[model samples]
Target: MKTPVIHLDVDRLIQRIALFALAGLLTIGLSVLGFHHWQMSDPYVRAVLEIEGDVSHGRAIFQMNCAGCHGDSGDGLVGPSLHSISAHKTRASLIRQVIGGQTPPMPQFQPSPETMADLLEYLETL
Candidate 1:
C-alpha cells in the first residue's frame, strides 16, 4: 500500500500568519483606546478637567505636597521625574495616579477637584 503525501502551501501559510498578526494588533489598539475613553469618562476625572487651573497656585500646591519626592523642579528624586509628564500621560491618567496611589511609597492624595486642577497646571509647566 502506498501512503499519500500532503503538501502545504507556504505562501498561503505566510499570508495567514500576517493576517492574524494584523488582526491582533488591531485588537490591542482598540482595547487601549477603549480603556482610555473609559478613564476619561469617569465623573471625577471629568469634573477635575472642567475646572480652570491657576499656575501660581498649582506651583504652590506642588511645592507643598510633591516637591519632596518629585524635586523642586519636577526632577526625579525619590519619585520619578515628572518633566514633560503631560506629554507622556493624559490628564485623566495623572488624576487617577495621584488619587489612586496605586504605586507604592506614594500615598493617596485626594485633593479637591480645584486643587487637583491646580496641581495639574503646575505639572504641565514642568
Candidate 2:
C-alpha cells in the first residue's frame, strides 16, 4: 500500500488567505474602538477640557463632594488645603489629579469627567 500525498487546493488556499486578511483588518478596527485610540485626535478627547458643568453647580459639588476634605474655604483637612490650588497647579493638572487620585491616602473620586472639570474650575475661583 502507498501513502496518499495531500495536494494543496490553490483556490482554497487563496480563500483562506483572504479570510485571514479580512479577519486581521476587523480585529484591528475593533481594537482601535475598544481602546479609543481612534478618537484620540478628536480634540473632544480629555485633551479638549470639557469642564461644561456650571460654576454654580460646581459650587454645590464642591460643598458636597469636596468640603469634607477641602472645607468650605478650600482649607486643608485630611487633604491638603486647596485655597490657592489654582496658583499651585495648572487647570489640566488639577483636573487630572482629582480624577486619577493620588497616594494611598487619597481615594479616586468617580465623578463624571464633566463634574471633575467643573470642580476644578470652581476650585480655581477659590
Strongest candidate by lDDT: 1
Clashes of 1: 0
Task: State the lDDT of candidate 2 residue by residue for 13-83, as single tens digits.
Answer: 99999999999999999996765553444343364265455778789888987788767878878877887
C-alpha RMSD of candidate 2: 11.0
Candidate 2 segments whose C-alpha is farther than 4 A from its true place: 1-48
Model 2 Cα shift for residue 75 (angstroms): 1.1
lDDT of 1 at 116: 96
Backbone clash pairs for candidate 2 read none
* Clash pairs for candidate 1: none
